[model samples]
Target: MNRTLEIELIDELIALKSARGLFLEEDIGHAPVERYASDDQFDTELELVFRRRPHLAAHVSELAKPGDFLRVDLAGRPVLVTRGKDGVARAFLNVCRHRGAQLVGENAGCQNRFTCPYHAWTYASSGELISAPHFASGFPDADKTQFGLTAMPTYEALGFVWVVPSPDSSLGAPFDFKNYFAPIAAEVSELDLADHVQVANDRISVAANWKIIVEGGIEAYHFKIAHRDTIAPFFEDNLSSFRSLGAHMRSIIPRVSLARLGDSPRDGWRLRDHANTLYSLFPTAQFLVQQDHVVLIVANPLAADHTELRIATLVPKSEAGDSELWMRNHAITRTTLDEDFALGESIQRGLTSGANAKLTFGRFEGALTAFNQSVADTIAAVS
Candidate 1:
């Protein structure tokens, strides 16, 4: 973050601590419960949001060398992302030109060529159809160029690879990656995220609406009640603040020990020392910046009440040897999130039960309100 914003956040934290209160919105916000339970709404979101947005595929570190590749499933399409010999990262449909068989099934690997097990149709790491067994008599006039994998527009920024599922007609225009990320680009750039090595990457299926999972991360109003046995003791009760970064949001939840910073000189007060900053990266990802490491939580919506949640732990390259410490950190975070996801599941069941017509967001849950508003506004504008 910039110096000015850092100081301002520090001031806000100190004042909120003194007042024993949290940042609040002007009024309560309401969202219909049907939005989470309707199959039609979920299908629309999958078509309008997931298929058109620039979804994060993998970090550059995951594809550090040429010929390195990773397979990711996005919006029901298996995407193959590879760093070619030319040192450019590219994405393509992970399917063969013939017979529609999946070309590569491994989660990740390093290889110069991929040969389809079904037909022996081979392709280079650069996505070129180099060879096909027995094409002489069966199909002598086959064009190698025309039989290559379907390509998807891929870009590397902030040390991550992002792919748009239908790039040509996404949002009815060319997706402007730079402009879309302008709000939080400089802040993320300052973190040198590319330099960090991913320590762990895992996924879990959650029985809850995607929005419920996302909403769980952007506010601290429920921490004291929802996480009483796990993380509640460490954090202050309902004490947090947030700011909207374009359509995305950034939130800060201070540790209960922040009051001790009052004894230290203001010059020595570091933001990370007293709080954790969580960045909600628009539609699919959340980045939690802690003192020693960063955690990325990605939500992939599978249905109106199902989501695949992927969590990744990233740490500085220098700390790669400290497996014990990183493991402990990862375990704690995972446990806390498991608690949150459980709550989301219960909430989803309630929504499905049709007991409530709408859900209410209080003043303290301003971050949730902002996030819901952003989603609504974006979908409305696109529709």
Candidate 2:
């Protein structure tokens, strides 16, 4: 972060600490329960929001080598992202061109050429068709160029690879990845995220709407009550602050120890030392920056009521070999997040029960309100 913004955030933290209060909205916000329970609404979101936007697919470290690759399912489409010999990261539809067989069954690996299992057709890491068996006699006039894997728009920045899920979408004309993320680009760059290596990556299927899972990360209103036995002891009671960055948001939840900074000089204050900064990256990614490590939570919507939560714990490269420390941090973070997901599941069940027509977000839950509104506005504009 720049010095100006750094000082500004510190001032906000000190003010909140002095007032012993949390950030508040002008009034309460209400969202229809149908947003979370209706299948039609879910389908619309998948088409207009998730598919059309650029999603953070993998960290650069995951594909550090020239031939490294990672396979992921984005908005129900199988995607294979690879680092080619030229050291460029690219994405393609993970399906064989011959018989439409799913290619690259493993989650990740290093390979220069991938051969189809059924037809034995092969492709280069750059997504070019390399060879096909019996080409001399069968379809001799066929154009191999047309048979290559379908490519998706991919951009690598800040040590991360982002891909547009739709194969037909252009990365330049309609959507510019750098411009779309300009608001928080500096903040993310300052963290040196590219220098951190992922120490642990885990996925959990949650029985809840994806939005519910995302909303749980942007507010601290439930820190004390919902996390009473887990993380509540370390944080202040509902003390947090949030700022909107385009459609995205950045929130800070201060630790109880932040009170000690009240007596310290402003020149010596460090925000990360006393608070956890969480960045909600528009559609689905939540990045939590802690004192020693960073946690990225991505909510992959499988259905209206099912979500796959991919959690990656990234630690500084210097500490990558500290297995014991990283494991301890990962375990604690996972347990805390598991509690939030459980509550989200419970909330989903209640929404399905038809007990209420709408859900209300209180003044202190301004982050949640803003997030839902962003989603609604984006979908509305596109639909």
Candidate 3:
């Protein structure tokens, strides 16, 4: 290899090591109430952080394109999002202009227009009120232009969509969440996520606080106990070494397993020793990178104690068809994910019982704590 190339390789290795090495147990477990499931402050804080933080809002903004649409219920408000013809993704309240019925009910699909079912009111994809059942005479004062769907504040970035449900929200100033993610963003970019396409997505409902599901993804402390048979065999149980960002954290697990994975592989699909990277993006999203695939789970809180987890598996684009490998991979991921959801739901049940007023986050899990604190600060500021 050239001398310059060798030097660059050495630098990259050192940087990777440094990124994975600098975490403290004290940091993971700090500020217990911040992440406590029963803490009302947790919900309040999260609402503020998500609604007010412009930088955080930018992550989903960058992913927008013309006609791109997604539906979201952020902080208890239903949002219908779309990238208009001009190539800007915008979010609007999904309610119909007449009698307030929801216009779009399906999860997501491309459309040139949205038609209201109640009275057959129709609107363009850009949210313009173009037609109605009785266009000539519903009411003389009813102007089509005045009845456009309500627009919400929106921005797309970082391969995700984000929305604020309030029409009066002051989130217009451009803030890039990718920048706030900083050095970690650069490190993650090494995975070349753009080349990967979603191969499988499993949506699940969990009877737990959304944050609890997030905690389950971030910390390795529970692996030896909660996931002994399932995950422990594939990951290092020791929590001494993990990496942290102020509001994000990732754990790297080597692929070596006790199952003789290296030698016993004669088969169709086998679990191999590989680097597994897990990332918890602040309050809700969890990104898990296995050797052959990337699993992303975003938890959306439906109620104080109910949450929905959206799981998407991204595989190399070449493996697009419905092949045996795809099915096998999806099955394995589904099983592991179900197990995690079970744990999260049961934990939420325990938390709601008032048996424990606080929950302790391990030092390696402090990124969870930091995120909770960030939520607290945001809610406080908004309040």
Please name the candidate that would achieve the greatest lDDT relative to the true structure: 2
TM-scores, all candidates, are 0.94, 0.96, 0.76
Write down the RMSD of candidate 1 (Cα, Å).
1.8
Candidate 3 wrongly placed segments (more than 4 Å): 1-23, 27-39, 42-46, 50-72, 133-144, 168-184, 188-192, 240-246, 255-274, 352-354
A best-first ranking of the candidates according to their lDDT comes to 2, 1, 3
Which pairs clash in model 2? none
lDDT (Cα atoms) of all candidates against the true structure: 0.87, 0.88, 0.62
Q: Clashes in each model (backbone N, CA, C under 3 Å)?
A: 0, 0, 14
Error of 2 at 102 (Å): 1.1
RMSD of each: 1.8, 1.6, 6.6
The digit string of per-residue lDDT tens for model 2 on 229-269 reads 89999998887888989988999888988888878887887
- Strongest candidate by TM-score: 2
Ranked candidates (TM-score, high to low): 2, 1, 3
